[model samples]
Target: MGGGGTAYLTGYEAAFINPANLAVPDKSTRFSIGIGTAAGFFAPVMSVGSASRQFQAYKNYLDAHQPEATAITASEKQLILDRNYPKGRSRSEHQHRMDLILGGIQWRQGDRAFSLTARTRFSTRTEVGRGWYDETFEDLDSSTSVRDMSLFQQSQFLHEFSFGYGQTFDFVSGLIPRVGKLYIGIAPKFILGGSYLDLQYDARYWFTDEMDQPLFTRSFSYRSTGNFSGATRHYTANGDPSAAVQRHFPSSFQQDFSDYTTPTGMGGGLDFGLVYVLTLGDDLSLAHSGNTQPIEKSLRLGFSVTDLGFVSYNENPRSLDHARDTTLTPFAAASGQKYEGSPGQYLSFFDEVPDLNPFQFNQVGRSDDSPERPFKAVLPTSFNAGMLLQVNRLKLAADLTLGLNDSAFNNTKLIAHFGMEFAPVKPVPIRLGAQVATDSPTLWSLGTGIVMKHWELSAGAQFLSPRGSPALNLSGAAVGGLTFHF
Candidate 1:
């Protein structure tokens, strides 16, 4: 429900969101098992109106110039640079995430609960600097220096097996005032790293003369690790870029499935949560007596910290570094060779430069003999706080999530979520939610579900739009799930 389940979710669903809710005494179902999946993609920087327009203009330019044209004209390059890379904006990022809850089970007895879940999460993020894009599209002008231009790409897939436990403590009426019950929970997970990849490229260039016969000094470094180690070897030894692409992005379905199922490392993580349910009306007497009976609560507050750990990959890892300060003439196609205008082709200019050879190095430990040393990647850690309010058959929830770090799966931004659930009838529930974050598009979501005595089914879709855009874009998510409760 629009990422606002931190306080209201219970049973199996709470295992990953906020385990404290598992021990809530008023839960209607004591046991539950479920399976679910979710996926989403977003480009935070591209949500601006100007950026969207520029992207469309760039696409139109590409379509207008087709098979006959191998390189963009100077004017065309200048147009793209002016439209896409405005002043004060130097970087853009795109991120994608997918999650699969293979299976989950939760059981509650009295004021205690236990849960077990198996899940897999995949995330990828790419960040490209303005200078990098300008260089790729052949827009670098004379008498200009591009420093700290970089392209960073990273991805990770992890399989998690978690064991959770939660318990409720009834506080004395006068000791804690209006607080009736306090819930605390923890989930420890054994993480199996399926695959991991981190690649970083940094380039610096100084151009002194005109475009066709310019003299430039350039330096660049490329570093990568994980499953791409073999592919990197192929590219460096045979100069075959397709091998590197094919290793991560298989053309065949069978190869893709095989790659998904492979394991590369192992690690551990933990989630901790706490919730306080306010006592209202006659519930004060029950709290003083430490009764286990269900108390109707009007308000609940929750907090949680998740994904507090790291995974170390021992898979073949490689790092390369190079620096050069020599003047080189502008790139020219060989006799009968066409400039494909591809990213690989543009980057290949560095290879033709004189005295610019890259050498491999160890990234972690300083042992020169062990180039395959293990490298560690941390999970996306975040702190979440939420509030849930209940009145009759309607529920209102609000959540705030603050990412602790900017990893592949997380960003250092504050995301706010608001959601509502109403049950007009006993067996049907309707949900609506919205999310807002700084420098990102807003998202609106709608969901509905069928809730029977023993089973439930749910589905939801999210819509995204820029702050000033007239219509929503097709850049959101769809999620569905099935669960059994007893």
Candidate 2:
């Protein structure tokens, strides 16, 4: 619920959050199996300067008017540019994430627990400067001189198999009457790298009035490295395939399933967690058989460090670099041609223009068919800590997550989540949650779950908006899962 599972989750659902919780499953559950999926997007409009206000205006305009228009008017185009583009140098970022739990099983006996899970994760991020947006929509007569304008994108997909174990320690339970038990857990994961892509583009442009046609000089460099066959391809300057370059491109997803199943890389990772539960009244003896008597707890505290490893991609990996400086007439457009197709198709246009000929696409790594020097991509590591409080039929929880590094899946920022759950009836529970981050708008979520003796089902949705402002659900997410326990 709103990414607040660090402390209170149990059974199979705790495999990814805090494995220590697995050892504290329901009193009657000895085994559990589950499947789940989640997807989300975050495109924060920063509240610095007028950019955020303009973005809201632009969104409102689109929502109110634009459902039936075939062609955009000049006034509309100008209005869009004025509203969306920043006044000076600025940047915007967008991120997307998806997770799939193919299957998972958890088994607990006495004070020990074990789990195995198979899952896949995908994430991507894109960042662009204001100059890039202005260049795309501004009129030809608009004189804009921009330096060091840049666009960057990174994406990765991976399948993981994890084995986890947790053990409870009650040696100190009797010393502190208020402390119920302590649990520690560790999970080692085998990761299969499905695909990876990193693209960086930078440009400098200036307009010169020295010539009658207003000479425009532009210099740019483009670099990309990965096995993203669906998005990019390479060819020799003669418009033919080079035998020296290994063409690992797959034609289509419908025709080839191996494109996704094949491993472009391989790596390993580990997760560590610790949890302590505090007793409310009387402390239960650890001598009980099968731990039949449940440990009564008023508060629970959890901590974990996850995804600490790297993947080295060596199988047919490709790296391309291109840089050029050219001078041409202002606002020159190729007749009867529109920008379309993949990156390879768009780059082909440079070869057709006389002023931009001699375009050279250089491969950076080894040229032979043998394995190339590997490129290492690190995992999105993070540290999480949270606390949960239980009171009769009501529960409250709060968590804090700190990203250790910046990547497509994680950012180096602190995020806080707060959640509450109330069980009006024994078999049904209602939940409400909220999230706040350093650089993004606030997120609110509502969810419900049905808990029976042998089966469980849950679903939730998230909405994004600024606090104290008109609610504009610019982004949303939906997640659902099913689990069976015995």
What does the lDDT come to for candidate 2? 0.61
Best by TM-score: 1
Q: lDDT of each prediction vs. the true structure? A: 0.62, 0.61
- Per-residue lDDT for 200-226 in model 1, tens only? 544444443444544444444343354
Q: Candidate 2 regions off by >4 Å?
A: 36-89, 135-148, 170-175, 202-231, 235-261, 281-297, 320-372, 466-469, 472-476
State residue 178's C-alpha deviation in candidate 1, in Å. Answer: 2.7
Winning model by lDDT: 1
**What TM-score fits each model?**
0.76, 0.72
lDDT of 2 at 13: 51
Pairs that clash in candidate 2? none
